[model samples]
Target chain A: MPKQAPVPDELSKPFWDACNERRLVVQNCTACNRMQYPPEQTCSECGSEHNLEWREVSGRGKVNGYCVMHDSRIRLLQADQPFNIVVIELEEDPAIKFLSHLPGTPVDQVPVGASVLVDFQEVGPGQLIHEWRVVG
Target chain B: MAPTGWFPTTRNRSQEGLGVWEHRGKVAVVGIGNSPTARRWDETADTSVGAWAISAAQKALDEAGISRDEVDGVVTCPQGMGSPWAPNPIPEDFAKAYEPTDNPDDGLTGVSADWIVKNMGLKNVKATYHTPACISPALCAGAQVVGDGEASTVLVIRGTGNFSGRYGQYGAAAGDTASGPGQWTNPWGWQLIPQIAYGFDQYCRKYGSSHDRMAPFVLNQRKNGALFPEGYYYQHRPDDLKISVEEYLSARWICKPMNIYDCDMPIHTAGAFLLTTAERAVNMKQKPVYVLNHVSQRAKVRSSVETLDETEAFTDSIARKVYEGSGLTASELDICNPYDGFTLFTQYFLEGLQWHGVQRGEAHDFYAGDISVKGPHPFSSSGGNNGNGRTRWWNQLDCIQQLRGTAGERQVTLKAETALAGAFTPNMSDWMVYGTSPD
Candidate 1:
């Protein structure tokens, strides 16, 4: 099976569109001035419905945590077996973290709290996914 | 500690009434039943969704000495009945029989209250199905129905042939066919195993815990599994009972920070609990376990925010609410059946419930003999999901058995006068405390 692609809904379209352009974006609440991932219709912090905006974020952040997958439930993920999945806490807002794969980083080198940069890859015809790689 | 009194408050079943501790304990679990875990190859012509459900329900009813005609209320979880890959012998998936007319989702996406009434061949009954929460929701719903005078006898049933039926595995097919949030996780290689592993990895980072620290919890579960004759690992893989730290670490890692032992063994099984008013249960054949409290809560936020908030997932507030409602402290609980979907959950729950004031960073004696059936504080003596069968809400069944003093060799030494059962899944959490006798 091909890699699992997220079925972007109306609320998440802009976030995916930005990812398609190799730019990382998240929903920034105007009221609370906080960033949210996995875009939702309403601002989770302030409950502001009308002022939510998609803001591009500098995807440089410290690794909140990570896991090295030696086996995957999905066969596609196992194609590149023994991969690393990292949760990156974006610098724009430390609370706003994104879940992504650490494509090229070795298991031991994928350190928790290490600075990382988001890198984009085209996994399908029109689908693009963001990955994280450790940076000095 | 002995079980608390029943219905400490006056007759009021409204939102305000919920605050009153007396509103609870009016309902009791009168009967319990379980079906053997099956494998993919164990399918027969009769193992349809309806057949499996009927088998457990019949057993529970027989234990209660209540006939089909006596049941006035029914609650069910059909989450497992839909897998097209499983050989469900029923003519069609149960969802198709009564898909909500309003909802757009089709196929086995939903199960209506009418479906259970029809399939179980029961007469006029107040039936509600498809309100799927983790197994605890059905228990809470069943208890409330009897307590509120909606029904004299309520039957709560949960059956999942998912493991044997759905591609002979715990998870569904990946990629394009993936359903729910699972599809979203796949592209990032965030399958269920790793996603959960990350939860523990984050916890370890915050609390400074290690594989060695968590190892004993898994070992304790395996030890309990050996005592549980029904556990698949106990019966088939007897060697699992003797797992060592070296064997656990050397085992091929499914995900970093988590080995094969950390994951729950998915098996095909079904469990049912029969609930009725304390008055009705007085005449029942078996001992009635009083339902002290059934409280559920959801996090204020959803998605990544909640997922990343390691503390929120196992918030102390969840346990505080249960303790406040049940009027029972951690010490008062003779037995606690915390959700063990993952072995790591044991720590999350122990800390969340403030069991012995155990904090996130405090050292826990998971290796103490008290963690076993004969110990003072036995955890999921039925081996939990770790070693026992992974039937949703199976912990509740174990709690009932413990309180009824029918757990056989695995029964807790406290006489199980007061027991706590908690379930945490995704964004939702629920807890219920049971007692041996009414106040």
Candidate 2:
């Protein structure tokens, strides 16, 4: 089964567009100079709706926190049993981390503060999502 | 002076007490009631969401000594799942017994405020419905309507039957232009458990907290739940009550750094609270629990904002306003009940309330003290949402009970004194302080 895909709208179209191109982009509030995630209509930091822009990010972050799903009631997720769902804190902004499944990593070896790089995988037709891999 | 109809910005001493805050002593919780909480597998026709709410409302009204005719305002905090007619697609099995009436379009969703009012035969009542049920907001709404002279009595009702269906049945993270599970989190395989596990993970990294340090707080809740006769775990699953660190550690992990016991028990339950003017409360049948302060507001980041470090200083605003508005300190509170849907929230809110002195980005021994029913500061004397059934507004119920000096075996030492209870949703935090009388 294909991986879970997000339903994107106009406010989030740009971020998802960047993902299809294998680029990590986030919403930058021109007013507050604060970067945010999961794209929004306005800057959550400054409430600026007019000056929002989609900007590419380094896509490198440290492990903020994570969990290992030993079992899932959802059938589609069961194929990737015992996977690690990591919340990565982007290097550009500690507060702007995103959620992604970290495949092929030993659960015990998962580092809480280790650096990681973002990569994309096709979840469905013409659909690409950002994922994380540990970096030395 | 407190605002007669609306609260002013500055603090003022009023007839109620210091810093009456607009609603202080203006609205009183004259009655509290709960339907027996049971597992979904144990659900009966009587336990349907509507039935549970009606039963609870009847009891609360009975306790208040107010007839249905007296209720002019009804505030409904419906479950997260959609109404029976157009039910949520995810929890497909839930409310299957609910058959759409001949007039499904009449807007009488069984859980809606209008339906509740009609069912109770309340006359000339203004009904307000709060979508995506979270009980705290309803309590705050009820207090506002009555305190502002909009109505004399308001009935706040909330119930959840998710246990019979499933969690995440309604999806996570709400947004506009996008319906059904919002972006980032769901697409990335993140749900409630993983999301919270991440927050606690960050807490551990910054503060140096480990499993050992966090277990005591959860254990304190278990102990408190054990003391309550009606607690689901203690009563039905008696053997599960005496959980230890060893047992907790050995349990299978649903999410990293969190075990099975770290989460809340999912059970179907309904609760009702009756709000009336303080003067009227004095004439009621039950002990009056005055609404000293009701503060509900957002923190720095909206809950919808998907971020890695969401927990950092998120509850700061809630803490600041609750302390300042209520004119009470952590030490002054005889009982404290924070949202404990997840044990992590209990710890975070405890620290936010200054019950513990843990600094940000640093960890301390969370289990160092006895934070039990007999502890220095009694927290969740009714076992909270963790040990108790997730009755949605159990915090308020427990707070009212403590302040009324009727908590029975789980009674707090400072009964009939100041008690603080908090409610937390994804992006917002609200707190309510209750006192036995006008201070």
Per-model TM values vs. the true structure = 0.87, 0.86
Badly placed stretches (over 4 Å) of model 1 are A1-3, B1-18, B81-83, B86-115, B163-173, B176-184, B233-242, B300-309
Write down the C-alpha DockQ for each prediction.
Answer: 0.54, 0.39
Alpha carbon lDDT at A16, candidate 2? 74
Model 2 chain B: weakest 10-residue lDDT segment is B1-10
* Deviation in Å, model 1, residue B28 alpha carbon: 0.4
Per-residue lDDT of model 2, residues B1-439, tens digit only: 1101222212112112234476777789998877776655243445566667788888999999989889888776654332233332322233343433233311212355755765566776854545334677777777777887878888888766644344443333222112343455565456666767766766776666676576777777778788766567765776776888788778777676667777776666677899999989899999899888877655455333334344545555466667776777766667778888777656666666665454453223535656667655565676777777665566788788888878787886554487778666434655678888766
Q: What are the clashing pairs of model 2?
A: B206-B361, B207-B362, B207-B363, B303-B427
TM-score of chain A taken by itself, candidate 2:
0.91
Best model number under DockQ: 1
